[model samples]
Target: MEMTTEILMSTMNTTGNGTIDGGNDVVTLLSQVSNILILVFLMISMGCTIELEDLKETFRHSAGFFVGMLCQFVLMPLIAFCLSLTFKLEGAGALSVLILACCPGGTLSNLFTYWTEGDVCLSVCMTSVSTAVAIGMMPLNLFIYSRVWTDDKAVIPYVNIATTLVSILIPVAFGVFLRWWKKEWTKYVTRFGVVLAFILIIVVWVLFFMLNPTWLFAGWQLWICAVLLPFLGYGFGYSLAILFRQPHFKCRAISFETGSQNVSLASTLIVVSFADSPLFLDMLFYPGLYAVFLYIDSFIVIMLMKGVMHLKKRRNSANDEDHDENKNDKIGLDNEGMATDQEDGVKVVAMKQIVADNSVKTDEEIKV
Candidate 1:
């Protein structure tokens, strides 16, 4: 049976009280507040890692940055839209995928880049540039892609998107200012931001269980989104870089940057934007699941990168060994040739001496 858009959107109606039609008002309030705080912390911490030089460096090598942007804004969103259509997700499930695809590369990209021995500077630059660009691109991407599938543009929370963009930029700019003013304090402040981020992740975990314990078994489409989204990002990201002939390290950086969406930001947007919707309970559950799978998929990518590096190292070492063995064999042949020449010279010298002795002996016999 096909469900109508109105029925899907009406899953939750607003009650006279501050709650969703059937959800608890207190839970909704708590989730929004927590989401705001978490987004702030994650954005600020992400900012701390960016320096003015990193921004300039992105411009210095604008080609690579633009390539990364292509991957971030173009390839990923298209992949997600295709997946959404494939899964035939409706309502929140569909929106969740769209929102994630529109999000910029996460701070986790930098960490993964370092783990994979990628160009950290490029990774940082890409992350910062993408985040800043996302302020505008996020909305545009959603507007363009979501329309392809759904006609109800009202389903999109445009105001929340603006709010999320402003909220994210302010804290991030402030963090960057702090780093510029007191470089010494960036470490401590960044550490604190990380702690807050972790706490927020935990809050999300708890909310999943406390609010919607049955989400895991609700739908297979969500699982499809959770598993494929990040994998596609990683695959397409690396492929794009290689296709463009980007250096290997930069390729790795872009791969991680593409795959790791800012879960914290996505969570905040989902929680706050959908807070008033009756479908909040049903729709809000997918972001957390997406987060869980994104990380898992990224971890797998890291391990694969490590494994590739290990194999490359082994192959290089084998090549070096073969080169050395070839050199040794050449040296041995040269030494053998030198010994043969030296023996021939010695024999010639002895024969000349013998001829001179015989000539002297014949002269002495003539004198006698």
Candidate 2:
């Protein structure tokens, strides 16, 4: 687990440098292929685990989901824009930030929401909806933003779009369908999917490291951005939830959803769209920093949530014990009172019988 985590961290950090080498191209390609396959398998597994009922539940919370989407689509991008202006980051840096903002929420949101005792169903639904929207929104947002900020024109590669559909959406739909048609298969796929995902993530990171050893120590600006952006995202999300009077759990979920951008997709887009340019090199920083911040911050948040949950459980257990003891004591006192009343009544009846017998015996003696 530790080794896998380290690899993921490395892959996330290797964003700007094209650290991948020609010698390791074959391995990287294989790893990317494997990653895609694993993702498909995981989606299938998710479909199996998700009942129609789960979807219904998710839909019921559509209002909350829409609110979250608004945060991602409207609020976050605006913030990114404002940040770009404040930082005076034009050209590649500005475009990169915009690209990060435009991309939808990713798979990690579900994990983080679950970790924080947030609504997993809502997170999943949001991911699906955001991904679907990204098909159109990603291109539009990038094109407009790039045009405004840089000389570079944004183009969404059709091949990459198709690949995304095949790898992500098709598999998810298939998984959902399989879950309804062949329930048992879904379970098997989900289990296998997890192992596959871990392996692919590891391979990608390893190849990244092998390709760019120096980048491992470089990209301080990227790292800083990564750390700060998520923190800002969470803060904004939580504040919005609080202002709206949303529940604590939902608040946590929204915070995570807002903060965790789709770094993987962003990285892929940068590679495919800007492979030749030095701008592509700069663009790498956004996803690299985003990934690094996400893993570290998420770990801390999850651990804190776990600790809080443990304390809550202990308190609840203690309260239950106290309630039970109080109920038992009340029952014992009631029984004792009933027993004393019965004993007094018995004594009174015995005394009455004795008086009657003595009076009858005295009458008989007088008659004799």
- The most accurate candidate by lDDT is 1
lDDT against the true structure, per candidate, is 0.72, 0.67
Off by over 4 Å in 2: 1-21, 82-91, 114-118, 139-153, 156-166, 173-192, 212-219, 238-253, 268-278, 354-368
Cα lDDT of model 2 by residue, 155-213, tens digit = 65455445544555566667778888988787677768766765766666666555444
TM-score of each: 0.72, 0.78
Alpha carbon lDDT at 243, candidate 2? 80
Question: Judged by TM-score, which candidate is best?
Answer: 2
Please give the distance, in angstroms, between residue 226's alpha carbon in candidate 2 and its true position after superposition.
Answer: 0.9
lDDT of 1 by residue, 1-368 (tens): 00011222222334457345445445545555666676677667666777888767767877788889999999888988888788888777887777777888876676677668787668766776787788778868878887764444333344534554566568768877888999899888877877876676567556534554444764889888889988989899999999989999889999888988876456555555565765556665566577677768978988999999999999999999999999999999999999999999999999999999999999999999
Q: Score residue 193 of candidate 1 by CA lDDT.
A: 77
**Which 10-residue window in model 2 sums to the lowest lDDT?**
1-10
